[model samples]
Target: MRQLIVTEFMSLDGVIDSPGGGDHPHAGWTFKDIEMDEAAYEIKGREQEEAGALLIGRVSYDEFAPVWPKMEEFAEYNAMPKYVVSTTLTDPQWHNTTVLRSLDEVAALKRGDGAPLLVHGSANLAQNLAAAGLVDRYHLLIFPILLGGGKRLFAPQDAEKQKLKLVEHATYGNGVQMAVYDVVR
Candidate 1:
């Protein structure tokens, strides 16, 4: 079965919102004050190299479509098959993009034979996948900053207890940490 991996650059206070886009008050916090260290992002490069397909929600797809396709750094993702989950998104403009309307479709995709599906910056979709017990893995790059209040990866009180096993972790000199976890079934 193909694993569904949700990856994100999150703050220490568990804020994943406004990492780049200006939709949130603390937008662009990912790069604004944080020093750009090549070594800190090594895992991101490696994951992009290893990912088979990309999965994202409608909002993320809209936010990334124009920029990521034109950016050279995201060339690997540009070439890979991309899946966007949305009921209203009938047509996706990005190359190799497909729209999956329901969580059931996502589950089916996970069951199909393929390389692991890497999800990036899709907060709502990621939470939904976890709630549905469809998320297989997580690749978190936790920064050393706290933005106080924002959208977090997990809810404050989750009714369903989903256990996770830490399979890999690394703390960089730039105060950035990379953690890889597999959901314990």
Candidate 2:
């Protein structure tokens, strides 16, 4: 079975929104709040090297399409297959992109042969995947700060508890931590 890995940059307070800069007042908090250190992002390079494909929601797809394809750093992702979960998206302009209609389709995708699907910064999509018990692993870079408000990687809601096993972890410069947890099934 193909694995689904959700990756994100989250605050100590669990805020995962606008980490790179956006409309949020605390936009770009990740860099502003923590000192930039190349060592802190080594996991990012490693994960991208290992990821087989990219999976994202409409909002993330929209936000990344124009930017990733243009950047040399994301060449691996640009070449790999990309899936976007959206009922409304008919045509995708990004190269090697496919539009999936629903979470059921996502589940089916997981059943098919492929490398792990790496999900990046899709808050709504990530939450839905978690609620559906579809995420297999998480690659998180938790920064040490409290961004009091914003969308979170995990939200407060009533749902069955899902067990996880910490399979890999590391701490980098500026007090950033990388934890890779696999969902215990």
lDDT tens digits, residue span 1-185, model 2: 89999999999989899998776789998888799989879888987898888999998888899899999989999999999999999989999999999999999999999788999998999999999989999989999989899899888587678889999998986899989899999
Q: For each candidate, what is the lDDT?
A: 0.90, 0.91
How well is each residue in 1-185 modelled by candidate 1, as lDDT tens digits?
99889999999988899798758788998898588888888888988998899999998999999899999999999999999999999879999999999999999999999888999998889999999989989999899998998888885475488899999999987888999999999
In lDDT terms, how accurate is model 1?
A: 0.90
Deviating ranges (above 4 Å) for candidate 2: none
